[model samples]
Target: MNKLIAIMNRVLSLFCISLSSILVACVIWQVFSRYVLNSPSTSTDEIARFLFIWVGLMGAAYTLGQKRHLAIDLLAMKLENQPGKQAALKLIINLISAVFTTVIMVYGGGALMLKTLATGQISPALGIEMGIIYAAIPLSGCFMSIYLLKDLLDNLTDISSSGTSTL
Candidate 1:
Protein backbone atom coordinates (compact mmCIF):
# COMPACT_ATOMS: atom_id res chain seq x y z
CA MET A 1 0.00 0.00 0.00
CA ASN A 2 2.77 2.44 0.91
CA LYS A 3 4.58 1.57 -2.27
CA LEU A 4 1.47 2.17 -4.31
CA ILE A 5 0.95 5.49 -2.63
CA ALA A 6 4.53 6.46 -3.21
CA ILE A 7 4.24 5.61 -6.90
CA MET A 8 1.04 7.58 -7.19
CA ASN A 9 2.69 10.56 -5.50
CA ARG A 10 5.61 10.43 -7.87
CA VAL A 11 3.39 10.17 -10.91
CA LEU A 12 1.22 13.05 -9.77
CA SER A 13 4.27 15.17 -9.07
CA LEU A 14 5.66 14.48 -12.51
CA PHE A 15 2.33 15.36 -14.06
CA CYS A 16 2.21 18.66 -12.22
CA ILE A 17 5.74 19.54 -13.23
CA SER A 18 5.06 18.73 -16.86
CA LEU A 19 1.83 20.67 -16.89
CA SER A 20 3.42 23.70 -15.24
CA SER A 21 6.32 23.68 -17.66
CA ILE A 22 3.98 23.47 -20.60
CA LEU A 23 1.81 26.22 -19.21
CA VAL A 24 4.82 28.50 -18.80
CA ALA A 25 6.01 27.76 -22.32
CA CYS A 26 2.56 28.43 -23.65
CA VAL A 27 2.35 31.76 -21.85
CA ILE A 28 5.75 32.79 -23.14
CA TRP A 29 4.80 31.85 -26.65
CA GLN A 30 1.55 33.73 -26.32
CA VAL A 31 3.38 36.83 -25.21
CA PHE A 32 5.94 36.52 -27.97
CA SER A 33 3.33 35.92 -30.60
CA ARG A 34 1.28 38.90 -29.53
CA TYR A 35 4.12 41.33 -28.98
CA VAL A 36 6.73 40.21 -31.49
CA LEU A 37 4.63 38.66 -34.20
CA ASN A 38 1.65 40.98 -33.72
CA SER A 39 -0.70 38.01 -33.76
CA PRO A 40 -1.91 36.13 -30.67
CA SER A 41 -2.04 32.34 -30.72
CA THR A 42 -5.60 31.43 -29.85
CA SER A 43 -4.88 27.70 -29.50
CA THR A 44 -1.96 28.33 -27.17
CA ASP A 45 -4.12 30.48 -24.93
CA GLU A 46 -6.78 27.79 -24.61
CA ILE A 47 -4.20 25.07 -24.18
CA ALA A 48 -2.55 27.07 -21.43
CA ARG A 49 -5.85 27.48 -19.63
CA PHE A 50 -6.49 23.77 -19.78
CA LEU A 51 -2.98 23.00 -18.62
CA PHE A 52 -3.36 25.43 -15.77
CA ILE A 53 -6.48 23.67 -14.58
CA TRP A 54 -4.74 20.29 -14.63
CA VAL A 55 -1.69 21.68 -12.88
CA GLY A 56 -3.70 23.33 -10.15
CA LEU A 57 -5.84 20.26 -9.49
CA MET A 58 -2.95 17.81 -9.66
CA GLY A 59 -0.79 20.04 -7.47
CA ALA A 60 -3.56 20.09 -4.89
CA ALA A 61 -3.68 16.30 -4.87
CA TYR A 62 0.07 16.09 -4.55
CA THR A 63 0.01 18.49 -1.61
CA LEU A 64 -2.75 16.51 0.06
CA GLY A 65 -0.76 13.32 -0.34
CA GLN A 66 2.20 14.98 1.33
CA LYS A 67 -0.07 16.19 4.13
CA ARG A 68 1.03 19.71 3.33
CA HIS A 69 -2.42 21.17 2.86
CA LEU A 70 -3.35 24.03 5.20
CA ALA A 71 -5.18 23.22 8.38
CA ILE A 72 -6.01 24.87 11.71
CA ASP A 73 -4.28 22.48 14.06
CA LEU A 74 -4.21 24.64 17.17
CA LEU A 75 -6.87 22.57 18.87
CA ALA A 76 -5.22 19.29 17.96
CA MET A 77 -1.89 20.53 19.25
CA LYS A 78 -3.46 21.65 22.49
CA LEU A 79 -4.96 18.22 23.01
CA GLU A 80 -1.70 16.36 22.48
CA ASN A 81 -1.46 15.41 26.14
CA GLN A 82 -4.90 13.80 26.03
CA PRO A 83 -4.49 10.80 23.80
CA GLY A 84 -8.16 9.98 23.58
CA LYS A 85 -9.15 13.55 22.79
CA GLN A 86 -6.43 13.89 20.24
CA ALA A 87 -7.40 10.66 18.58
CA ALA A 88 -11.02 11.66 18.46
CA LEU A 89 -10.23 15.07 17.07
CA LYS A 90 -8.02 13.62 14.39
CA LEU A 91 -10.61 11.06 13.43
CA ILE A 92 -13.31 13.70 13.23
CA ILE A 93 -11.18 15.92 11.07
CA ASN A 94 -10.26 13.08 8.72
CA LEU A 95 -13.84 11.96 8.44
CA ILE A 96 -15.04 15.44 7.64
CA SER A 97 -12.37 15.89 4.99
CA ALA A 98 -13.16 12.53 3.47
CA VAL A 99 -16.84 13.29 3.20
CA PHE A 100 -16.26 16.72 1.70
CA THR A 101 -13.85 15.52 -0.94
CA THR A 102 -15.93 12.48 -1.83
CA VAL A 103 -19.17 14.36 -2.21
CA ILE A 104 -18.12 17.65 -3.70
CA MET A 105 -15.10 16.72 -5.76
CA VAL A 106 -15.78 13.12 -6.63
CA TYR A 107 -19.52 12.93 -7.12
CA GLY A 108 -20.16 16.50 -8.12
CA GLY A 109 -17.20 16.69 -10.42
CA GLY A 110 -18.05 13.40 -12.10
CA ALA A 111 -21.59 14.58 -12.69
CA LEU A 112 -20.43 17.85 -14.13
CA MET A 113 -18.02 16.09 -16.43
CA LEU A 114 -20.73 13.76 -17.65
CA LYS A 115 -23.10 16.64 -18.27
CA THR A 116 -20.49 18.41 -20.31
CA LEU A 117 -19.77 15.29 -22.25
CA ALA A 118 -23.40 14.87 -23.09
CA THR A 119 -23.59 18.43 -24.27
CA GLY A 120 -20.78 17.72 -26.77
CA GLN A 121 -19.41 21.16 -26.28
CA ILE A 122 -16.00 21.81 -27.77
CA SER A 123 -13.40 24.31 -26.76
CA PRO A 124 -13.38 27.39 -28.97
CA ALA A 125 -9.73 27.35 -29.87
CA LEU A 126 -8.73 23.74 -29.22
CA GLY A 127 -11.83 22.07 -30.61
CA ILE A 128 -11.61 19.40 -27.94
CA GLU A 129 -14.48 18.06 -25.89
CA MET A 130 -14.84 20.04 -22.70
CA GLY A 131 -15.50 16.94 -20.65
CA ILE A 132 -11.99 15.69 -21.27
CA ILE A 133 -10.61 18.85 -19.72
CA TYR A 134 -12.99 18.71 -16.76
CA ALA A 135 -11.74 15.23 -15.87
CA ALA A 136 -9.11 16.78 -13.64
CA ILE A 137 -11.72 17.45 -10.98
CA PRO A 138 -12.68 13.86 -10.33
CA LEU A 139 -9.14 12.63 -10.85
CA SER A 140 -7.85 14.95 -8.15
CA GLY A 141 -10.74 14.00 -5.92
CA CYS A 142 -9.86 10.32 -6.23
CA PHE A 143 -6.23 11.06 -5.45
CA MET A 144 -7.23 13.06 -2.40
CA SER A 145 -9.52 10.30 -1.18
CA ILE A 146 -6.73 7.77 -1.56
CA TYR A 147 -4.40 9.89 0.57
CA LEU A 148 -7.09 10.58 3.17
CA LEU A 149 -7.89 6.88 3.52
CA LYS A 150 -4.24 6.05 3.98
CA ASP A 151 -3.89 8.72 6.65
CA LEU A 152 -7.01 7.47 8.40
CA LEU A 153 -5.74 3.92 8.41
CA ASP A 154 -2.35 4.94 9.69
CA ASN A 155 -3.91 6.99 12.46
CA LEU A 156 -6.12 4.09 13.51
CA THR A 157 -3.21 1.67 13.48
CA ASP A 158 -1.12 4.00 15.61
CA ILE A 159 -3.90 4.60 18.08
CA SER A 160 -4.58 0.90 18.40
CA SER A 161 -0.97 -0.22 18.64
CA SER A 162 0.16 2.40 21.15
CA GLY A 163 -3.07 2.26 23.11
CA THR A 164 -3.20 6.04 22.68
CA SER A 165 -2.98 8.78 20.11
CA THR A 166 -0.30 11.36 19.41
CA LEU A 167 -1.39 13.52 16.54
Candidate 2:
Protein backbone atom coordinates (compact mmCIF):
# COMPACT_ATOMS: atom_id res chain seq x y z
CA MET A 1 0.00 0.00 0.00
CA ASN A 2 2.73 2.39 0.95
CA LYS A 3 4.64 1.59 -2.21
CA LEU A 4 1.56 2.16 -4.32
CA ILE A 5 0.94 5.47 -2.67
CA ALA A 6 4.55 6.48 -3.17
CA ILE A 7 4.41 5.54 -6.82
CA MET A 8 1.20 7.52 -7.25
CA ASN A 9 2.83 10.49 -5.59
CA ARG A 10 5.72 10.35 -8.03
CA VAL A 11 3.50 9.99 -11.09
CA LEU A 12 1.20 12.80 -10.03
CA SER A 13 4.19 14.98 -9.28
CA LEU A 14 5.65 14.37 -12.72
CA PHE A 15 2.30 14.95 -14.41
CA CYS A 16 1.78 18.27 -12.69
CA ILE A 17 5.36 19.36 -13.33
CA SER A 18 5.08 18.58 -17.02
CA LEU A 19 1.76 20.36 -17.41
CA SER A 20 3.05 23.40 -15.56
CA SER A 21 6.15 23.47 -17.72
CA ILE A 22 4.05 23.36 -20.86
CA LEU A 23 1.84 26.18 -19.68
CA VAL A 24 4.81 28.33 -18.77
CA ALA A 25 6.53 27.62 -22.02
CA CYS A 26 3.40 28.43 -24.00
CA VAL A 27 2.93 31.75 -22.20
CA ILE A 28 6.57 32.65 -22.78
CA TRP A 29 6.25 31.80 -26.43
CA GLN A 30 3.07 33.85 -26.67
CA VAL A 31 4.87 36.89 -25.31
CA PHE A 32 7.84 36.39 -27.59
CA SER A 33 5.71 35.99 -30.69
CA ARG A 34 3.65 39.10 -30.01
CA TYR A 35 6.46 41.47 -29.04
CA VAL A 36 9.48 40.15 -30.94
CA LEU A 37 7.99 38.67 -34.09
CA ASN A 38 5.50 41.50 -34.69
CA SER A 39 3.01 38.76 -35.55
CA PRO A 40 1.66 36.56 -32.80
CA SER A 41 1.02 32.89 -33.17
CA THR A 42 -2.75 32.60 -33.22
CA SER A 43 -2.72 29.37 -31.32
CA THR A 44 -0.39 30.64 -28.61
CA ASP A 45 -3.15 32.28 -26.58
CA GLU A 46 -5.60 29.41 -26.96
CA ILE A 47 -3.04 26.73 -26.18
CA ALA A 48 -1.83 28.63 -23.13
CA ARG A 49 -5.36 29.10 -21.84
CA PHE A 50 -6.20 25.43 -22.26
CA LEU A 51 -2.90 24.30 -20.77
CA PHE A 52 -3.50 26.58 -17.80
CA ILE A 53 -6.59 24.62 -16.80
CA TRP A 54 -4.72 21.34 -17.12
CA VAL A 55 -1.84 22.64 -15.02
CA GLY A 56 -4.10 24.07 -12.33
CA LEU A 57 -6.08 20.86 -11.93
CA MET A 58 -3.02 18.65 -12.07
CA GLY A 59 -1.11 20.87 -9.65
CA ALA A 60 -4.02 20.81 -7.23
CA ALA A 61 -3.87 17.01 -7.21
CA TYR A 62 -0.13 17.19 -6.61
CA THR A 63 -0.67 19.53 -3.70
CA LEU A 64 -3.25 17.16 -2.29
CA GLY A 65 -0.69 14.37 -2.24
CA GLN A 66 2.04 16.61 -0.89
CA LYS A 67 -0.41 17.79 1.80
CA ARG A 68 0.43 21.37 0.87
CA HIS A 69 -3.05 22.74 0.15
CA LEU A 70 -4.29 25.62 2.25
CA ALA A 71 -6.79 24.57 4.92
CA ILE A 72 -8.97 26.87 6.96
CA ASP A 73 -8.35 25.96 10.62
CA LEU A 74 -10.78 28.22 12.40
CA LEU A 75 -13.30 25.50 13.23
CA ALA A 76 -10.81 22.78 13.97
CA MET A 77 -8.89 24.93 16.47
CA LYS A 78 -12.05 26.10 18.25
CA LEU A 79 -13.15 22.53 19.03
CA GLU A 80 -12.97 21.06 22.51
CA ASN A 81 -10.34 18.35 22.32
CA GLN A 82 -7.07 19.42 20.73
CA PRO A 83 -5.29 16.35 19.43
CA GLY A 84 -8.19 13.88 19.28
CA LYS A 85 -11.22 15.76 18.02
CA GLN A 86 -9.05 17.85 15.80
CA ALA A 87 -8.14 14.83 13.77
CA ALA A 88 -11.69 13.54 13.71
CA LEU A 89 -13.15 16.85 12.66
CA LYS A 90 -10.54 17.09 9.99
CA LEU A 91 -11.46 13.66 8.71
CA ILE A 92 -15.12 14.56 8.60
CA ILE A 93 -14.30 17.70 6.69
CA ASN A 94 -12.21 15.72 4.24
CA LEU A 95 -14.97 13.19 3.85
CA ILE A 96 -17.44 15.93 3.04
CA SER A 97 -15.08 17.36 0.45
CA ALA A 98 -14.60 13.93 -1.04
CA VAL A 99 -18.34 13.36 -1.28
CA PHE A 100 -18.95 16.73 -2.88
CA THR A 101 -16.19 16.22 -5.41
CA THR A 102 -17.41 12.75 -6.18
CA VAL A 103 -20.79 14.15 -7.10
CA ILE A 104 -19.23 16.68 -9.43
CA MET A 105 -17.15 13.91 -10.93
CA VAL A 106 -20.28 11.91 -11.55
CA TYR A 107 -22.67 14.57 -12.76
CA GLY A 108 -20.73 17.52 -14.10
CA GLY A 109 -17.54 15.79 -15.17
CA GLY A 110 -19.04 12.54 -16.26
CA ALA A 111 -20.88 14.14 -19.16
CA LEU A 112 -17.69 15.79 -20.28
CA MET A 113 -15.60 12.66 -19.90
CA LEU A 114 -17.66 9.54 -20.51
CA LYS A 115 -20.23 10.75 -22.99
CA THR A 116 -17.89 12.74 -25.20
CA LEU A 117 -16.60 9.61 -26.83
CA ALA A 118 -17.23 10.97 -30.31
CA THR A 119 -16.28 14.54 -29.50
CA GLY A 120 -14.61 16.55 -32.22
CA GLN A 121 -14.16 19.66 -30.11
CA ILE A 122 -11.01 21.38 -31.17
CA SER A 123 -8.88 24.13 -29.70
CA PRO A 124 -8.77 27.51 -31.44
CA ALA A 125 -5.00 27.57 -31.70
CA LEU A 126 -3.46 24.17 -32.12
CA GLY A 127 -6.75 22.59 -33.15
CA ILE A 128 -6.13 20.22 -30.29
CA GLU A 129 -9.04 18.08 -29.16
CA MET A 130 -10.83 19.80 -26.30
CA GLY A 131 -12.29 16.52 -25.18
CA ILE A 132 -8.86 15.23 -24.37
CA ILE A 133 -8.09 18.34 -22.31
CA TYR A 134 -11.41 18.36 -20.51
CA ALA A 135 -10.79 14.76 -19.51
CA ALA A 136 -8.45 16.07 -16.79
CA ILE A 137 -11.34 17.36 -14.69
CA PRO A 138 -12.71 13.94 -13.74
CA LEU A 139 -9.26 12.45 -13.69
CA SER A 140 -8.09 15.03 -11.18
CA GLY A 141 -11.24 14.61 -9.15
CA CYS A 142 -10.65 10.87 -8.89
CA PHE A 143 -7.10 11.39 -7.72
CA MET A 144 -8.13 14.07 -5.26
CA SER A 145 -10.88 11.87 -3.89
CA ILE A 146 -8.39 9.05 -3.43
CA TYR A 147 -6.12 11.32 -1.44
CA LEU A 148 -9.00 12.27 0.82
CA LEU A 149 -9.85 8.61 1.39
CA LYS A 150 -6.25 7.82 2.20
CA ASP A 151 -6.13 10.67 4.70
CA LEU A 152 -9.36 9.55 6.32
CA LEU A 153 -8.09 5.98 6.62
CA ASP A 154 -4.83 7.11 8.20
CA ASN A 155 -6.71 9.16 10.76
CA LEU A 156 -9.06 6.28 11.47
CA THR A 157 -6.16 3.95 12.03
CA ASP A 158 -4.47 6.36 14.37
CA ILE A 159 -7.61 6.81 16.42
CA SER A 160 -8.32 3.10 16.56
CA SER A 161 -4.83 2.19 17.73
CA SER A 162 -4.76 4.93 20.35
CA GLY A 163 -8.34 4.46 21.57
CA THR A 164 -9.02 8.09 20.92
CA SER A 165 -12.57 9.43 20.95
CA THR A 166 -12.17 11.54 17.87
CA LEU A 167 -11.99 8.74 15.37
Candidate 3:
Protein backbone atom coordinates (compact mmCIF):
# COMPACT_ATOMS: atom_id res chain seq x y z
CA MET A 1 0.00 0.00 0.00
CA ASN A 2 2.80 2.39 0.87
CA LYS A 3 4.53 1.55 -2.37
CA LEU A 4 1.32 2.18 -4.29
CA ILE A 5 0.93 5.56 -2.62
CA ALA A 6 4.53 6.45 -3.38
CA ILE A 7 4.05 5.57 -7.02
CA MET A 8 0.87 7.59 -7.20
CA ASN A 9 2.65 10.58 -5.74
CA ARG A 10 5.49 10.29 -8.22
CA VAL A 11 3.06 10.02 -11.13
CA LEU A 12 1.15 13.06 -9.97
CA SER A 13 4.41 14.97 -9.56
CA LEU A 14 5.47 14.17 -13.10
CA PHE A 15 2.05 15.07 -14.49
CA CYS A 16 2.08 18.47 -12.78
CA ILE A 17 5.65 19.16 -13.83
CA SER A 18 4.88 18.39 -17.46
CA LEU A 19 1.74 20.49 -17.55
CA SER A 20 3.54 23.36 -15.81
CA SER A 21 6.29 23.26 -18.39
CA ILE A 22 3.71 23.60 -21.14
CA LEU A 23 2.28 26.64 -19.42
CA VAL A 24 5.71 28.17 -18.97
CA ALA A 25 6.60 27.57 -22.58
CA CYS A 26 3.40 29.20 -23.70
CA VAL A 27 4.14 32.24 -21.51
CA ILE A 28 7.63 32.55 -22.94
CA TRP A 29 6.29 32.34 -26.44
CA GLN A 30 3.63 34.90 -25.71
CA VAL A 31 6.20 37.33 -24.31
CA PHE A 32 8.62 36.94 -27.18
CA SER A 33 5.93 37.29 -29.79
CA ARG A 34 4.31 40.34 -28.20
CA TYR A 35 7.44 42.30 -27.37
CA VAL A 36 10.40 41.11 -29.43
CA LEU A 37 8.64 39.98 -32.56
CA ASN A 38 6.00 42.70 -32.44
CA SER A 39 3.42 40.14 -33.49
CA PRO A 40 1.16 39.16 -30.62
CA SER A 41 -0.87 36.03 -30.70
CA THR A 42 -4.48 37.01 -30.38
CA SER A 43 -5.19 33.74 -28.64
CA THR A 44 -2.12 33.77 -26.38
CA ASP A 45 -3.94 35.19 -23.40
CA GLU A 46 -6.74 32.65 -23.64
CA ILE A 47 -4.30 29.80 -24.07
CA ALA A 48 -2.33 30.97 -21.07
CA ARG A 49 -5.49 31.13 -19.02
CA PHE A 50 -6.38 27.58 -20.00
CA LEU A 51 -2.89 26.39 -19.19
CA PHE A 52 -3.11 28.07 -15.80
CA ILE A 53 -6.30 26.17 -15.16
CA TRP A 54 -4.61 22.95 -16.11
CA VAL A 55 -1.72 23.53 -13.72
CA GLY A 56 -4.03 24.45 -10.89
CA LEU A 57 -6.17 21.35 -11.29
CA MET A 58 -3.39 18.90 -12.07
CA GLY A 59 -1.27 20.05 -9.14
CA ALA A 60 -4.05 19.42 -6.63
CA ALA A 61 -3.46 15.72 -6.19
CA TYR A 62 0.26 16.26 -5.76
CA THR A 63 -0.37 18.91 -3.14
CA LEU A 64 -2.72 16.58 -1.32
CA GLY A 65 -0.04 13.93 -1.25
CA GLN A 66 2.27 16.41 0.43
CA LYS A 67 -0.48 17.66 2.75
CA ARG A 68 0.25 21.10 1.36
CA HIS A 69 -3.26 22.46 0.99
CA LEU A 70 -4.13 25.78 2.58
CA ALA A 71 -6.42 24.98 5.52
CA ILE A 72 -7.55 26.51 8.79
CA ASP A 73 -6.42 24.48 11.77
CA LEU A 74 -8.89 25.94 14.27
CA LEU A 75 -11.49 23.22 13.77
CA ALA A 76 -9.37 20.61 15.49
CA MET A 77 -9.48 22.68 18.67
CA LYS A 78 -12.94 21.26 19.38
CA LEU A 79 -11.34 18.01 20.39
CA GLU A 80 -9.01 17.70 23.36
CA ASN A 81 -6.19 15.68 21.86
CA GLN A 82 -4.35 17.31 18.98
CA PRO A 83 -3.46 14.35 16.79
CA GLY A 84 -6.85 12.60 16.85
CA LYS A 85 -8.80 15.76 16.30
CA GLN A 86 -6.50 16.86 13.54
CA ALA A 87 -6.92 13.51 11.88
CA ALA A 88 -10.69 13.62 12.11
CA LEU A 89 -10.89 17.16 10.84
CA LYS A 90 -8.64 16.36 7.95
CA LEU A 91 -10.75 13.36 7.00
CA ILE A 92 -13.89 15.45 6.96
CA ILE A 93 -12.26 18.16 4.95
CA ASN A 94 -10.91 15.72 2.42
CA LEU A 95 -14.29 14.07 1.98
CA ILE A 96 -16.00 17.40 1.45
CA SER A 97 -13.36 18.54 -0.98
CA ALA A 98 -13.68 15.34 -2.97
CA VAL A 99 -17.43 15.76 -3.21
CA PHE A 100 -17.01 19.37 -4.31
CA THR A 101 -14.54 18.33 -6.97
CA THR A 102 -16.91 15.65 -8.20
CA VAL A 103 -19.69 18.16 -8.58
CA ILE A 104 -17.54 20.55 -10.56
CA MET A 105 -16.22 17.74 -12.66
CA VAL A 106 -19.64 16.46 -13.57
CA TYR A 107 -21.60 19.65 -14.16
CA GLY A 108 -19.10 22.34 -15.00
CA GLY A 109 -17.06 20.02 -17.15
CA GLY A 110 -20.04 18.71 -19.06
CA ALA A 111 -21.41 22.20 -19.63
CA LEU A 112 -18.13 23.52 -20.92
CA MET A 113 -17.65 20.62 -23.27
CA LEU A 114 -21.21 20.77 -24.51
CA LYS A 115 -21.10 24.51 -25.14
CA THR A 116 -17.90 24.28 -27.13
CA LEU A 117 -19.09 21.32 -29.14
CA ALA A 118 -22.47 22.82 -29.93
CA THR A 119 -21.11 26.23 -30.81
CA GLY A 120 -18.34 24.78 -32.97
CA GLN A 121 -15.83 26.79 -30.97
CA ILE A 122 -12.20 25.94 -30.57
CA SER A 123 -9.04 27.45 -29.22
CA PRO A 124 -7.81 29.91 -31.82
CA ALA A 125 -4.19 28.91 -32.07
CA LEU A 126 -4.32 25.18 -31.53
CA GLY A 127 -7.81 24.56 -32.87
CA ILE A 128 -7.90 21.62 -30.51
CA GLU A 129 -11.18 20.05 -29.57
CA MET A 130 -12.66 21.79 -26.58
CA GLY A 131 -13.52 18.49 -24.98
CA ILE A 132 -9.81 17.68 -24.92
CA ILE A 133 -9.06 20.77 -22.86
CA TYR A 134 -12.18 20.57 -20.76
CA ALA A 135 -11.28 17.01 -19.86
CA ALA A 136 -8.86 18.36 -17.28
CA ILE A 137 -11.64 19.02 -14.80
CA PRO A 138 -13.01 15.49 -14.50
CA LEU A 139 -9.57 13.99 -14.76
CA SER A 140 -8.30 16.15 -11.96
CA GLY A 141 -11.39 15.43 -9.96
CA CYS A 142 -10.73 11.73 -10.27
CA PHE A 143 -7.15 12.28 -9.25
CA MET A 144 -8.21 14.34 -6.26
CA SER A 145 -10.72 11.66 -5.26
CA ILE A 146 -7.98 9.10 -5.14
CA TYR A 147 -5.72 11.28 -3.02
CA LEU A 148 -8.52 12.23 -0.65
CA LEU A 149 -9.47 8.62 -0.13
CA LYS A 150 -5.86 7.81 0.61
CA ASP A 151 -5.70 10.63 3.14
CA LEU A 152 -8.91 9.56 4.86
CA LEU A 153 -7.69 6.00 5.08
CA ASP A 154 -4.34 7.00 6.44
CA ASN A 155 -5.84 9.31 9.05
CA LEU A 156 -8.42 6.75 10.16
CA THR A 157 -5.72 4.15 10.49
CA ASP A 158 -3.61 6.55 12.45
CA ILE A 159 -6.48 6.98 14.88
CA SER A 160 -6.91 3.23 15.08
CA SER A 161 -3.22 2.81 15.77
CA SER A 162 -3.44 5.37 18.57
CA GLY A 163 -5.73 2.83 20.29
CA THR A 164 -9.27 4.21 20.90
CA SER A 165 -7.85 7.09 22.85
CA THR A 166 -10.02 10.05 23.90
CA LEU A 167 -9.91 13.23 21.87
Best by lDDT: 1
Per-residue lDDT of model 1, residues 60-115, tens digit only: 99998998988889998898778766876777788898998899999999999999
Q: Which of 1 and 3 is ahead in lDDT?
A: 1
Question: Pick by TM-score: which candidate is best?
Answer: 1
What lDDT does candidate 3 reach at residue 46? 73
Count of clashing pairs, candidate 2:
1
Q: Using TM-score as the measure, what is the rank order of every candidate, best first?
A: 1, 2, 3
Candidate 3 global lDDT: 0.76
**Tens-digit lDDT string for candidate 3 (53-155):** 8888778767866889776766666664567666666667777887877688756776777787787777777787777788777777777777777777877
Going through the candidates in the order shown, the clash numbers are 0, 1, 0
What are the clashing pairs of model 1? none
Cα lDDT tens digits, model 2, 1-167, are 66767888999888878877888888899899899998887787887787788888878877987889998778876875566777778778888888876888635776786566466767766877777878888888888888888888887886666566443
